[model samples]
Target chain A: MKGNEVLAEAAMRAGCRFFFGYPITPQTELAAYMAKKLPTIGGTFLQAESEIAAINMVYGAAAAGARVMTSSSSPGVSLKGEGVSYMAGADCPGVIVNVQRGGPGLGGIQPSQSDYFQATRALGHGDFYMPVFAPSTVQEMADLIYDAFDLADEYRTPTMILADGMIGQMMEPVLLPPERDLSTLPAKPWATSGSRMERKHNVINSLYLSPNKLEDTNYERFERYEQIKEKHQRQELMSCDDAQIVVVAFGAASRIARTAVRDARKKGIKAGLLRPITLWPFPTKAIDELCDGGASSFLSVELNMGQMVQDVRLAVNGRASVDFYGRTGGVLPTPEEVLQAIEKVAAGEPVVQSAEPGAVGSLLPHPKHRKSSYERGE
Target chain B: MADYNHELLCVLSGFGGQGLLFAGKIMANCGLIDGRQVSWMPSYGPEMRGGTANCSVSLSDDAIGTPFITKPTALIAMNQPSVEKFAASVQPGGAIVIDTTLAMNGAEGVELADGVEVAAFKATEIAEAEGLKGLANIICLGKLWSLTNFCEREVADAAITKCVPPKRRHLLEPNLRAFQLGIDA
Candidate 1:
């Protein structure tokens, strides 16, 4: 199955029965799959008029103690951000999927990892963080959706599956997990499913008018976030021991970085890869340990205009030289480009630690694979 | 036997409705049937059926690093524009199969990178002769199959069986016949 279809089926298997989403490129396949399959299994699938309405529907269903989900691509996700913040404020548990596309405003429909800042730092208007899983493969895409639901419920926060269009459109063999029993799920006593004279009626609201109560609630939420960071941060390290340089990437970009690391190794460049499976916790300790293990340089690669470079710079903290390479606006970086960047930085060339995105130093050279200007009739 | 450690990357390109994506999918499924890791990614926009389309398929014995292919080991160009655009990107010693009926160049006057092999054939004409007018994609796949032999012919047959939906089961026979004609050619 395609990755998006596998993800939809996996959501169903994980007992998510309420899906609300609008059609968007790259992620529309997931919504279409849900539309077709959910109804047959007695699940509710509704396509709202807009992305904002879709996410709000997710919020409503999640507050009523149902496993709910919504998905969209780049611009649509931006539309859903306000609803995301409201859900966070209400402390609702839901799953939101961002099959990201190239963007600042309706950027081309090709794959991109440009939403790193939005997803990990500020998905909504508030000061809150959710667990964000960046899946590199189709199987990981399916597996992460199941885990995201569990994490959301445990933390009472919205979790996001951050994938690019590449992973969503790609087809690969995936083993879907067995269907989960909704009956086996943990009880949600805080749900607004009516009191029925059992005890006190549960009030699910984000509006704590009193300033002191709001501050206390914010503190409690931060404590939970701290706990999640301490326990749930996930990363995959490849050949970091006895490495001279380490390459860090997540999601689609990591796949190319992985191949480049292997190529660098073949050329006797002692290169390793650190793939961040979870972007939320930032994997700061892992970077620290790599620095401690005598890694002299770090490279951060992404399919965006250097959005994640800031986080890596923060984590490395001048312990070692850090360089960045990115391909923005839907163009993907090749393994050769990654290798060239690592070689350039490793060969005693001063790393251009530029924070300015799309600068000549921060991007791999323009693709020679494209038709020349003359051939393009320019 | 092909070395399992050596990965194969191929791209199929043409008009959006030319079944290029399906051809790529079949190759990917063939890899899966042979117990190899595979990834197939299509490059099509919101308007899927009228514009230019292409897809990349990678097959490997180990985990595939990425689905994007900048320099493919092989390519099948179904139209002139596809050949003009992608011919320069084939890796050294790579193979490219071109459909001669639509790709007017026929491997002549086309400047390619070093050591690339170009196979030009009238695939659409061949398909039409067999009353398989829309099966040129499969014919091209067969010719490419003959050159690269990425997997056994039987494996390709099984892939076609798996790729064709149950509702379109009747298509399997004609596609197989078209594939056989290309192989024979």
Candidate 2:
């Protein structure tokens, strides 16, 4: 199954009956799948006129206590930010998928992790955070999206699947999750369903007029965030015991880093991989544990311009030297390239810390203006 | 039965409408049939608009990390641009299959690393001769299978059957025939 289609199927099996989305490349297949499958299963699939409209529709459906979702690529996700913030302020539970592409403003349509900061730090103008799940493989795409809906409803907050185009367009065999019985789902008591003249009508709104009341709501939301940070921080550690250099990565970049770490081990380098499956609750505990265990250095590999490296640095907190290696604008760093970076770090050489203008140009040179290493007989 | 213990990374490249992605999909399905770990990833987005199209397929007994293949153990190049773009990247001791009918030079001027094997076949001409006009991709697949023996013949046939949609069932027989022709050629 393709990753995008697998996410749609998993969302369906997780009892999601409402899908509101606008078409965007790399993620359009997911919406098309929902448009084709949702109606046959007695669900609602609406193709709104714009991304803003789509996200607002998701907020509305979620307010009515439906397992609803919306998906888009990078720029479209920026347009939906306002609605996401609205949903967060209103305490609406929903799922948002960002199959990220190259960006900063109408960037090219290629697989990129440039939206890392956007997804984890500033999804919208807010003093709030969304639980971001990053899936590297097709199986994880299914497994994580299925859990995203439940996590959203459990905490009454919008959850995001922060995937890249590589996962979205890739194909792999997946064991589809079993369908959930809608009757067994948790009831949303705060939903604004009719009062039925039996009790006070429920109200769903984010507009708290008084300053004290607004501050209270923010404090309450942060309390739930703190709980999520403590319990829901998920990570995968590979060969971390007695490791000198630890590579921190997630999503597609993590897959490459995994291979590089294995290769480094074969070459007698004590390298390990720490992959964070959840981006919001950034898995700081795992890093602290590795640091406590005497891991000396950390290398953060990504498909962007060093966004997640900031988080890794924060987690390390001067306990170890943290380095950043990446290629932005939808370019993927090969396992060999990452291994070379690992080798440099092992040899006590400083790898480049940022995606500088010259560095980015040299990574993938234009075929017309410059000869590749192969062409240059290197 | 070929050994399925090691990894087989393949890159199939051609024009947008040349069915290279479909060929990669069938190869991935064959890996699944054998219960091996597999992944297929296509080069998507604007570059696919009248530009070169390619896909990477990885099959191995162990877990696959990263579906993108920068250095492939096997390559099937169906056009001149694809041959020029990817010929130099095939790993040492790797095998490459090219459609000489389209890529006339057939990696002649390219500087391939040591121990690389090259097999040139007039797949497009052969397919057209056999009334399989759009099946050069499958023919190239057959030649690749013959050289590498990545999987059993029965597994390849089963994979093709699984991939050919029900509405396009009539193309199955012709596809198999074209594949056999390439194997014999």
Tens-place lDDT per residue, model 1, B1-185, is: 22323678898998888899999999999999988899999885843757678999999977788797887889999988888878888887778899999887876777877878788999999899889989999999998888788898899999999988999999999999888887787
DockQ of 1: 0.74
Grade the docking of candidate 1: medium
- Tell me which residue pairs clash in candidate 1: none
lDDT by residue for model 2 over B10-96, one digit each (tens)? Answer: 999988888899999999998999999999999886657878899999999888888988888889999999999999998888889
- Per-prediction DockQ comes to 0.74, 0.76
In the range A77-142, model 1's lDDT, one tens digit per residue, is 999999999999999999999999998998899999999999999989876899999999999988
Error of 2 at A17 (Å): 1.1
After superposition, candidate 2 runs with Cα above 4 Å error: A353-378, B1-5
Worst 10 residues of 1 chain A by lDDT: A353-362
All candidates' lDDT scores?
0.88, 0.91
TM-scores, each model vs. reference? 0.93, 0.94
Q: TM-score winner among the candidates?
A: 2
